[model samples]
Target chain A: MNDLRTKLMEAARSHSPSDAVPIGFEKQVMAQVLALKSTRQPGLLRAPVDAWALWTRTFLRATWSGLGVVMILSLGSLAVPPSDGDDSDYQGLMVDSIAMPIDETGGEIL
Target chain B: MSLLPEPSAVPSDLELVHAVRSGETERFEELICRYQARLFVMARRYARREDEVEDIVQEILLKAYTRLETWRGDAPFEHWLMRLGTRICYDFLRQHQRSREITSTELSGDEVDWMECQALPDGRADGKADAARTLVARVLDRLSPASRLVITLLELEDKSVKEVAALTGWSVPVIKVRAFRARLEMKRLIERLDREKYL
Candidate 1:
């Protein structure tokens, strides 16, 4: 029995796992897991409130979403294309109003 | 390396999971540090080459991260990792078998007896122990990866059938059958060696 146990332990001892992962393996794994979050659709809100009622509510939401698509399509058709007339003012300027650089004097913004 | 951490490290594996879910990185590192050895042990049984085992373990770690958002946390974290490791090992074996890379070498007494001596060390016969140990390692190399895994985990690790079944995703019947066949094969090898007057 002692021999058997010793044999078993010896054979088994070779199976011990090695330790040497990236210093921050958990962070890396979590980062990958977090990436999966974007692909996951959020669970239904107030899921199946009352099976029949929930079905009706979902139907309504679908109708609303379809209507939203139609509305955007209509609005998109009404928009005008941009004109070249606005390009001259910005092309001649050394800087734009929102993006001025600090001057060497530090007192002035150019 | 030390097996367990100091008692004051923090909370349980679940607490670490909660931290991970809350987007804290430290808890996740703690979780990995906590499990790396256990995972390596699991991976060792699946892969034939030590390097390959390490690779498989790293792949499993990557898989765990990618699949973790689905964790329901209804079970222990170690249990989940155990299951993951088992499944990964099972899949690795299945893939290897499917690839048809089985070695054609015949089993010999030198391999079996040496393996027995190294592993069983019964009362320590010191004169030839080193030679026996090497022979045993060589003989083990002759076994199929799946056989090595089942034998190591079941006979050596002392994991129960239910635990193995759960970890391996194999129904209890399959694990039983595989373990039974693996042991029978080992016994046959030993008997053959004895008949050949090598023992």
Candidate 2:
């Protein structure tokens, strides 16, 4: 096993790749690097809004949510029926009464 | 920026790194030229094709460039670069393993002959040496990526277990286990080849 291992190592060391870097390889790599640099926007330039923008964004978001709450409450109010306290009492009184005497001449319940 | 440093006044790796970090981007080319050959040699071990080797080297360089600011200049630049290169190689091996199935294909007549030659006393001849390398590559292809990497570092590169650990960031025990497993795997592969050749 040791002998085989040694032989394998020997073989590996002896073998070398035949491939060579093509001509102008460095030039090509540099060109690519330069192109990448040119296309990249500087971080400072890209970050135009800064802390002020963050503050504005947060304020706008808060305002929108507050406005949404108000709108929802208004809609809820519209969904409910309007009430007069006296009307409820009157309804209750009519429901409770079984019968009332009739005024014969006027044909009205008193 | 002032006039660029003259070629005669070649800067240290750390200085070059600092220059590149401080907006003197052109200095990066010097770093590339300085390490290109060594990086190419290291990359070739993992990549079978020329194009693949070149691609790996380019990727390594680009990564080094983008992460230059992270280097603390504590160790030699080459040492850090070597560790990075090994990591890249390991990743490539893992990806390759995932994408391809390991087939137990029969060795060709020439390959069988090469295997047989390795056992002979005079197998150190130039031609047989080449065949041996080809056989090693084929066998390595059959191994799991982890096993192949362990074997390459332990056996082929003659790295100590500690050194392998340092390069791979694996624990010493893990490196030892992987090395043992890799040797067994390689032995089985070679034995299978031998059996097939005889049959």
Candidate 3:
């Protein structure tokens, strides 16, 4: 194992492949450097936004996201339905607000 | 000797960097011209294709330009540039390693014979430096990115542990540990290759 390791190291050190920078590489870099900040935005916002196109794209993207949320919530609700089953307090509040008749004095009926 | 007064002194890398930061962006081009070749050589070790090498060099230069403000003058500019270049190459290795699939079929005839010779205790594979290099390269490619980076620096580049640590921003013990694991990985890869070839 040591011998193989030594041999591999010797072989790697012996392999000296030299590469010359491609022609115009410096110019290419300089060109990019000069345009770096300007190119970042890509002029996307400069173009006029068609209201219909904007809505269509928004609707398409939102469709999948909305569907995903709905599916997750549906599955979650099914997995853990309200199993405590103690709703008397909640039912009383609803009945009082919807069914009770109040006098002008606002006192409870005797 | 007709000595013309020495040609205009070449601007130091720091001077150019200062000029660049002072809004003389054109001076950055000189830095590019000075270091691009060295950067390409370093990048070529990680990337085999010419286009990939070019992209790596371009990224290093662009990154250096943008991050010039972060460089304190405590270290030489070349050292700083090389450290940055090393990190970029390692990143490139990791990103590309995912897509690089190696197989026994890719081994050349020379590489196979070379490996076979090494399998024997007394056998010697002389005059096959190219084959040895190919085999080593294949083994290196199969290694994880961290292992590949460590082995390349510690073995192929003949860097000391401290130097490797400095280049990679890793601690000395980390470098030592990685070097040990890298060697083990290489051994395993070579053994596997040998097995698969015969099987």
Every model's DockQ: 0.12, 0.15, 0.24
- Please give the TM-score that candidate 3 achieves against the real structure: 0.72
Order the candidates by TM-score, highest first: 3, 2, 1
Compared with the true structure, what per-residue lDDT tens digits does model 3 show for residues B78-166?
Answer: 99999999999999988888534566788998988887888798868887888998788777778889999999888888899999988
Candidate 3 backbone collisions, by pair: none
Candidate order by DockQ, decreasing, is: 3, 2, 1
Q: After superposition, how far is residue A77 of candidate 3 from its true place, in Å?
A: 45
What's the lDDT for candidate 3?
0.82
Lowest summed lDDT across 10 adjacent residues in model 1 chain B is found at B98-107
TM-score of each: 0.55, 0.69, 0.72
For residues A1-110, what per-residue lDDT tens digits would candidate 3 score against the true structure?
Answer: 66776877787898765759888999999899888745653431233446899999999999999999999999999998676877998999998898866576767565
Assign candidate 3 its CAPRI class: acceptable
The first chain of model 2 has a TM-score of 0.35
lDDT of each: 0.60, 0.75, 0.82
Better of 1 and 2 by TM-score: 2
> How good is model 2 by TM-score?
0.69
Model 3 CA deviation exceeding 4 Å by range: A37-110, B1-8, B99-103, B120-123
lDDT accuracy of residue A21 in candidate 3: 85
Chain B vs. true chain B: TM-score for each candidate?
0.69, 0.87, 0.89
Give fnat for candidates 1, 2 and onward, in order: 0.28, 0.26, 0.59
**Highest lDDT against the true fold, candidate:** 3
In candidate 1, the residue pairs with backbone N, CA or C atoms under 3 Å apart (3 or more residues apart, or in different chains) clash, namely: A6-B119, A6-B120, A7-B119, A7-B120, A17-B40, A17-B41, B115-B136
